[model samples]
Target: MDKDARDFINEYIASLPWLTIIESVNDTLVEDNYVGKIVIQSFKGDVEIMITIPQDFPLKGIQFMCIGITGYPHLMPNGLLCLNVAPAGNLAGELQEHFSKLRTWMMDYYESGKQDAHFEYYIFDADPKITFVFEEDGQKTRPAHCCGRFSYTSLRQQEISDERVWLVTGIGDTPSRFSATFMSFHQPTYEGLYFLLSRPPMINVNQGLTEYEDLLLLLTEEQKGYFFSTAASISIRSGYQTGCIVIVGYEIPSLQSGLQELRWEPFFISLQEYPLKRDPITDEIIVRPSSVSRIHWCKGINASYERMFGRGRLCSELTSSKILVMGVGAVGSQLAHSLVRGGCRYIDISDSDKIEPGNICRSAYTFVKTDIPKVQELFNQLVGISPHLEMQFNIAIEPILDSNKGYEKLKMYFSKYDFIFDCTTNKHLSIMLDGMQLPGRIINLSISNMARHMVVITGVSQIHVLKNRIYNKISPDKREPFYPETGCWSPTFEASNSDIAAPLHYVINELNYRLEKQLIIASFMIVREEMNHSLAYELTYDL
Candidate 1:
């Protein structure tokens, strides 16, 4: 402890007449790097207790541990009390709050237990090597079936946190090549076994499982026979490239979800080669396996659709729809980012320019300079956002618009998508798109000078109506002047990324709402930021 902390502790202890310090001793027994202990008299009676302070005292806070107490649900093996106290604030106030809570806990402990309604026992302990990712578990009647044998794929691998992370492609016989269409499905070479138990595999409810034999107690006689035979068969056939994985699942009820979900704990075990003997009476082959090698546990991560995207936040239409975004400039790049984060996976981006240093200040372009085209760089960025994202990029939109047979080629290309977002502020392009008989819907998105107004025009081609709406709604007096990219004069609008992103958030949410409700109509809308620091929305037309 520092001088300030020591002085504060001394002054605080002097003020409490009922509290008396017995001794000060150095100790480091707990997991939180405890530095020292202060044995003090109990606030109520003659009993004594120790208050252990971690190395980073005020930062990590302090924990109270009884000297020789037992049978307390909140106490750990080192006698440390598991007090769910908030982070430490002002030193004087935090010390006062902690002692006050400790006294209350002591008072309630003697009267009755203080266990919460949603407490559960730990089944098995493990030192995780890799994070196992799995699909989302939707609303089901029971947890995933814990059959004896299972299969997993190691094709998709990533290095995360200094370890190799593998995804759990499937749990049972049928495996899905989720989003990765290029991968072909075949019989997985790696396999493992699992066991399901109604009760925890423990010698006692409170004690931890230490040995391999204790696990067999939780299994039935029939399960034991199947487990031994499977282990023997796998040990004989399996090579030593990778050890086997055994999963133990327990049906634990949680009050938050009000469902009995399966709590899974996985471990890496070795079933290399076991000895076989013949039974005397039945003349049957019996396989006896060796003891469990390592009891370390591996981490399991749920990357299911429900958990990745907030539950029900991603709509079916948005997820399944193929979107084409044109002109990856300031507004268009931000819109592409918003679409991907909102769960639009399949997107095609088109841009004809290169990313310059100036674009980084007001656009999604990174600081790293590259000789590649903007669409290629943007495609690389979007693919890194999520493993499920599928995208392609091209520099053909501008060329197609300028050609003599532009409408024919553009219509043929645009028909492949469900929605085409036009963020290019080119009037000629919008006019041309509006006149063409296109198959997909055209939605024009743009921001005015100083990001004072944002316009969104949706449904069957309404470029003329959008222009009329903008002309009638925005006043000439409220217009702002244009600014140059550098000292040289190249006319461009003046607005930082934040200036545009603030209103674009509302636009994306509104678009999601429209898609969810299937309200794809010819509509013109404008978002205006008032001088009074308030926002207003104008719905000019909806047909």
Candidate 2:
């Protein structure tokens, strides 16, 4: 031990005449910590204490516990006294206060007169907090669930061992609620019960307690035998794993009736082991016969989802939302992927183009998707992003205004999504789509003239209105626009995917924000001249 710890230990021994040193620096059990124990002599009874102090003396305080007692008022599983409050000071000054608190805990067991005292539960070495899942052959990952009741098989490890591993399998709503199939022979099976508790009594056993007689009355002799053999704690699965137990136990007005009448809280407890008594009449070990619910396999996928995204309503809403993408080209591909990551549940894609090798410089999908159609490739990509994602793909044969059949089909397709994105930059197609009545809100996304501009028209179906707004908000640059393609018959603006990806991502994120803020246009351009330096080549819409 360090000098500070030695000094404090010496000081403690000299100051307390009643205390007897059992082990000095009992380093074996608790690893690399000072966990020396002491015994105290008192009139009421002989009290055994386990003192744990940090190696650092004055900086940290001492932890005192009274062990080896049972019955009346709940005690911690480890036999450590739960101090509601103790003095907050250096150990030299507060050792007496720590001793005094231990004295109080010691008296709690004796002061109460038998049955009137609160019930005490035995503590186990395992993790008190538990979310029970079924261990099955095919679906080991899923949680064990039943709407009302279920049947299951089980696998148990050898008894009298320190390790406790119980597998509850084959759960479902069957056996007619009174099947004696498993009762014919004794097999290593799950004999556990499923009941709700008022509090998470994993550690604090006092707050939530269901009567032993009440629980016993509900089970049969076979079940009681199984329950007594297993860990004496409740296992909670379903939506309660991520701490719904606390709310159902102490809060939630709907559960107040259960608290007042049934006195059952939504928590858990464990009695280390139940000692089975032999039947006096028959020479066999006595066990009650009850078809208590045994978990077959757990269906924890949805419960896991709930635990992950249940924190906020907006996230859950986003995951359940349906989105339609009219184009899977340059900017459109980036937008679709962004929306998917934001928890969009379903995305319906429509595009006439295919992913070409040349489009690799700007589109989200890489060269591997080149030969395949853009809509189909994007659909496959989205499926890979989230295996649970629902997606659909369609080839846009003609623009909405070109043919009556095309317009009707497109209209029906648009109706299914909560939001729509018209990402095709074709002017004729945009005007045609604007003319057709949309079933939902449509957002048009595109980049203009050498990727110097990103255009997004929300709510308004008129392409003319978006054009007018862009002209009014954006400022004119002094330099003439530079067309990117020289060899092609119809030269198009050349912009790298990096230069466009940010703007496309920004547009999708802002679309999620709604049209509450004015759209700001930002673009980067290169000024070619006799000299390498020039005036500011970037423009933005101030509004």
Candidate 3:
């Protein structure tokens, strides 16, 4: 016999409470040929296991039977244990290594007397989500060793008649393969409860498995009221060659009515092919990926989206409003793209600036003619993807004060719009629109720091209205004279002098830089505003 088989047998024998060695098999006497029956009569108050092993076992593996009702792998008909590790078909080959590990596990169970006992649990009532972080210290600092997020549901029973079930539909960054167990119970008697643990079949991708694949367990009303305490263990092995392991635990529902609680604790084991390192210049931590890293990262985007949002509610509130993008420049272009991908349908865009060679890096409409205005070019691009999209082009026109006839044009253009976006940094233009007191909300976006910085500010008339009411102060006049020194677009120009050029270099770069910064700020403001809207709706429901 191989050393591994001998070690397995020894470990299995050590775990049993009693072992009876049968002297002979089939009434034939063979040297060193004996059968052993090991029995675990009692474990942790209510579980038992029985095993029969033929000495010089024919298959070099032990055959075990579970007689009790509480432990895992509840025996089915035909004397086959429904163990997760013993699935049928090709997938069964994947468990060979785990089988070897289980042999050693029996020894560990004997030495330790029980499985790892540490657990951490979290219950998020507002979000109706439960999270478990299983670790030695309950900290989630290291991703390599940490179990990723696992979403769970909560069920409550009121006197076994009234029941409430809440499902956890969305989760972030969960593992590809997982399992679950459900324990349900009612009030008063906590000891007698029905429980069900299930390990579903593995869901595989084209060649690999999905990262968000998980098991769902269902329980009946009888199970909920009778089963008092439940425990679940989840193991996740990363598909990458690094082979990180994340183990988690969760306490099943308790019978007591007032406030049932569930929690999670996680454990992490690292399997790195190479050592991690820190960059000398950037001081950023980096881990070298094994050869299989690329394969794991090459999953389909559709699959990923399905895994994350398939069970969650669609964001209907986000779809109700239209997003108007005024400029298709660097910042406005990116914002429009992001908004479209985020599920906004109705978009209106405008930009007077023409497409130049330098605009390619910043603008989404890269296949435009050199002389086409950015707005017209971007409109064509957007319409190509969505033929019925609403769009307008007020290209090559500079915004001027109402006293100069430009205000009438601006008013006509903005009359039907829900929101006005200012992607241009021209102070004169901003001042003119601010003065007109446009009927709709105005969102101003700018960029700075080489396109990295952005600021977004929504100019709502409510603030002006509130200021007027509270302080009895008239809001400052919207129209202000452009200052020559501080203004981004200079007034000095000589149309007749063909040889003389305007201060183009300084103005263009500065305008782009400041707009980037303003756009960043605007992005934050928009997100906060949306979140506030969501909260307000939630509060209204509570009321």
Candidate 4:
């Protein structure tokens, strides 16, 4: 019977042009009462589709329709087939109209034979829900369920010492009544309770209660235990409303047991009216609302601010400040170390060069070995010294010249800083930084050739100094060249000379100038002069 049905379906398919587009067909017999059949079809327009079916002989004409088409109208999983033959829902009523058009589409696919095509399809009744179960670590348990109730009139009457006055106020206001109930099976600590209530979908604990009447009280130990062991309830009365209440409590184990035994568990119970139900085993009853709603408490300011400051100074003494270091070399390093020792936190360090062996003579990293990435190593070292310090290092100065790239990053880095430093010898970088319209004070330091001498400059912005008289006081021509050779002494001139030069000419010159007469010292003096001038200018400008 299966063989006859297969032959008939094959004939029917063969009669259609679409079926000719199919490249290969295969059938496999299974040992367990079933056969698997597959049809692989290659369409002309770079489209190929393979269809598989169980050989049950079509009870519903077709078991599965897997149509692969070229770029034309595209096959969709929905029965509303999109084909060039009919634009809409394949609504052609006549059998000839539908079959002829389908055959034509197949013929087109067979004839086109082009391969540059994309695939898109829609499947009807696709199950959107994920069916497979996946294992995940740390799944959160559901929050303990809770409800609340309060009666405004009953609460007011309870508060009243004079019945006539209470009646007058209650009748005059026609006060809206309120009640609240909360249930939990876990007895979270006081801290945990605050945390749970502080999160969204609950009350904002940060904003304390506005009215003195807003209060919370701990229910009796029996009531608390009753709430945690089972579903329990409470009854509350306020001026406005009354309803069922659920209560939760948290307990910390005694210090003798330590934190190992500390557990935060919740107990839940409901309260509707009158005397609350008591559990038999624990002998704990549901808490009355009046007993748990009259306590007045709030988070302290000092405690809140302490949480904000983390490991820093007392909240009252804390101030937003900045430290600027001009050069990121040895002396600057030592100075930074000193400042950190002095309790100055938050520093900005800048250097444009990778650590080199040549820099060892005077660099802070001289004792340290070579090949270490300097900025990061220095950062780690500084952080080790003072973990609270916020330090930033900028390795590139070119970006500073290219305003588009540099300004934004620099502005963000320096926006809230209180000080700036110029430890760099790169004239362009220094000048560019000095030229910036800064909100904080500027400090600069540089070492003469080697570590023989050092100079420090402190100044304010040019705008503050000049008072709009002239924006820039220092001219481009006045700025010192970065390289030693380009400075006052030219290497070319020294090289051209004979008797004055030695065998290792440049090295001898450097040693002679730096070591003998102390050229580095002299340069440091020059830097000191520049610093003095800068400080003078800042002072004058401030005036």
Top-scoring candidate (TM-score) = 1
Query: Can you give the lDDT of residue 170 in candidate 3?
Result: 18
How many clashes does the backbone of model 4 have? 59
| Per-model CA lDDT versus the true structure | 0.63, 0.50, 0.37, 0.35
lDDT string for model 4 (258-329, tens) is 321111111111233323345577765543444333212211111111122335432111123567665565
TM-score of each: 0.70, 0.46, 0.31, 0.29
Give the higher-TM-score candidate: 2 or 4.
2
lDDT (tens digit, per residue) of candidate 1 on 109-165: 623556656555553344555555554343423325445665555534434465644
The TM-score, computed over Cα atoms with residue i paired to residue i, of candidate 1 is 0.70
In order of listing, the candidates' clash counts read 4, 26, 47, 59
Q: Candidate 3 residues 77-129, lDDT tens each?
A: 22324334443232223224334444443445433445344321221111112
Q: How accurate locally is residue 386 in candidate 3, as Cα lDDT from 0 to 100?
A: 31
Q: What is candidate 2's TM-score against the reference?
A: 0.46
Worst 10 residues of 1 by lDDT: 177-186
Ranking by TM-score: 1, 2, 3, 4
CA displacement after TM-score superposition, residue 94 of candidate 2 (Å): 19
lDDT of 4 at 396: 47
